[model samples]
Target: MTERQQHKRRRGAGVAAGVLCVCLAGSGCAQSGAAAEDAREGEAVQAVRSAADALVGARSSKARTSMEMATGGTRVTIRGEGVYDFRRQIGQLKVQLPQDPAGTPDQRPIMELLAPGALFMKNRGAGVPADKWVRVETRSLSDGNLVTGGATDPFAAAEVLRGARTATYVGEDEIAGTPVRHYRGTADLGIAAQDASDGNKESLAAAAKGFATDKVPFDVYLDEAGRIRKVRHRFSFVNGQMNNAVAVASTTLLYDFGAPVDVRLPDGDDIYAGKIAEE
Candidate 1:
């Protein structure tokens, strides 16, 4: 791997670890050695379901996210820090991008603001102005394509767990020094994404991409209070012209529930009036 690739990999791993810390600190898991062995199959699954409910019902949270994927022979890795507010249905992310080997020097990292109706992206590169933020309509994002969109929502992890066909307790593990119960599942992607998207599909190709595999694996960790602490998953797809693209995501929830999160819109002078082409 090149230095840039190695750097991205390290950052991705760091984000993963950071997410664990967020989960542990947010949920405030206490150390209890017997809780792991005392867990019952049915009870553990129910606890996970309850945690999923709480996560979906949460108002706002701080999150760290990482995704590494290959699409059409180009590998892309993204690491992000952000806060999501379900009450406002909006979030803002500071994203780190790999340097472009084929571009001029001085390209800055990107910033993204996501809302239910729109996504705003700001990047400094050739042909793109430094002061403008590109506006993207999110209707196409409802096509269940993680690449195109859908991962921005903090509740996406809980939705994945709710759609699991089989959820198995995987014992306990320490995340950021806090004890948590681990659960693994094979989730039906169609159902999971559809649930997240409300079954809206603007692009048939994008909607069908995840169906290449009827199911995908997901893991979740829960604190003793039955609240979700962290989630991790790997996703792969091969269809149309995408080749065999694969993505892995690790997300950690931070702070207590109902913590205030403010995601303000960009100033009018800084907002670009033009629309972005579909991803």
Candidate 2:
């Protein structure tokens, strides 16, 4: 940690900045400032909805995500992917993996379990029942994707803003240096008493009472035709810890498929160790 960073405790300007950083890069089906893009909003929502529904039915996904997590001033980088075995009826949403697979280093696991319940986590082991995993997947009011953890899940968050007294569209901004439009709102999503990546799973269950199903602030950006371009959430008492995901400094649309994002299945022989996704 940098000298300036080490001094920051759980609550500080540093914390606010980190939370703002996350909101900006967050997700939604919104497309802003363009006639052509606005015309496509309806199509975009349908596409996302269909894809999400298909995923629940078929059980698999293939894609790459570059993730950066910053707490106070500490930031970590990781590559993420989602893989599932239909035959086994199981899915693994990997939030982090090494860019260099050759080293085959013994690394920690980032698996979110969304089947049968809600949870969030990283660095967990294998063979635990899927329901026990730490991850939550639900229909996003923004752009539906089996969102893993954090404020990614849509409905879980939207409900928090239900009948929110104060709401408004701010200007535009950036996250992690990426550009985006901004929206702002307020509500009361409770607190968390534990670390999402660590700590007891039961505590998480109680903590989620606020996180997974409570009230909080939200900022949603729509592209041209009110298509959710990006979404941000701010909640407190989460895990009884500091809260973020509230203010949207930026709204970025990560993926857009005129159609479905089909997941390519792996061949039996090709599914060996060290064999990640291949084009």
Candidate 3:
């Protein structure tokens, strides 16, 4: 070939080689990026699954709870404040029911004691004397006490994260002025029941069977110590009275780690055993 022709061929070959190199590099980088994303997702799932254990490591915390039920264009919210001892799996809450449709307070706040397998309530209305406490087995409740209690047990709420089937880190946020990492995911109640602690396993299993769907969607925030600062779970169940499904959102906020919490169960004599009236 002539010199100029050979030079032109050489230039074409160089250009083709450079293009091939760039293409190969781009493919490698794309694969690496995907692998990194997978690793991040795995880490997030592991972090959420272990958040409940982190609460136990903290021992105790003061908690605030809210449960909102919406049906037929009406929304009612129940609020509670309490302290929980994660290690002992016990706590106490003062739960306030919403006002009646007339917007007048009809009853006093109920004092609740949460234990391993039982729930105790004072000021529980419906023809029961305020002085007598009513004891209910958590396992016997169809909603597993998650909704029936008006407020979810803080420790139990955290335990729900143990069943996180999929989780995505949703960036950072603050709860009550403390910095936290947010995560969103869905948890299988059946899976959560299987992984839950002995105290909560049966109750969660009951909830798994009672709820409209086994999957519960949740949003959770964790502190630097990996302890859950705030968690919200969405649950749906058929409301017998309404004869329809009710959507309930339960939120638990935990703070003041290592807080002093003392919970004493009611004595047998203090618990009312007569036929209880239903509201």
lDDT of 2 by residue, 118-141 (tens): 334434444433233323323221
Per-residue lDDT of model 1, residues 114-188, tens digit only: 665566778834455777887665545433434444243455555555556667788889766778889887776
**Candidates sorted by lDDT, descending order?**
3, 1, 2
Model 3 lDDT per residue over 24-131, tens place: 999999999999988988899899999999999999999999999875688989999989999999999999988888778656999999998789999998878889
Each prediction's Cα lDDT score? 0.62, 0.38, 0.92
Q: List the lowest-lDDT window of 10 residues for candidate 2.
A: 192-201
Which of candidates 1 and 2 is the stronger one according to lDDT?
1
The total of clashing pairs for model 2 equals: 29
Which 10 residues in a row give candidate 1 its minimum summed lDDT?
199-208
Off by over 4 Å in 1: 1-45, 56-58, 71-76, 100-107, 124-126, 142-145, 149-152, 193-211, 239-242, 245-247, 250-258, 266-279
Give the lowest summed-lDDT range of ten residues in model 3.
98-107
TM-score between candidate 1 and the true structure:
0.66
Model 1 error, position 73 (Å): 7.0
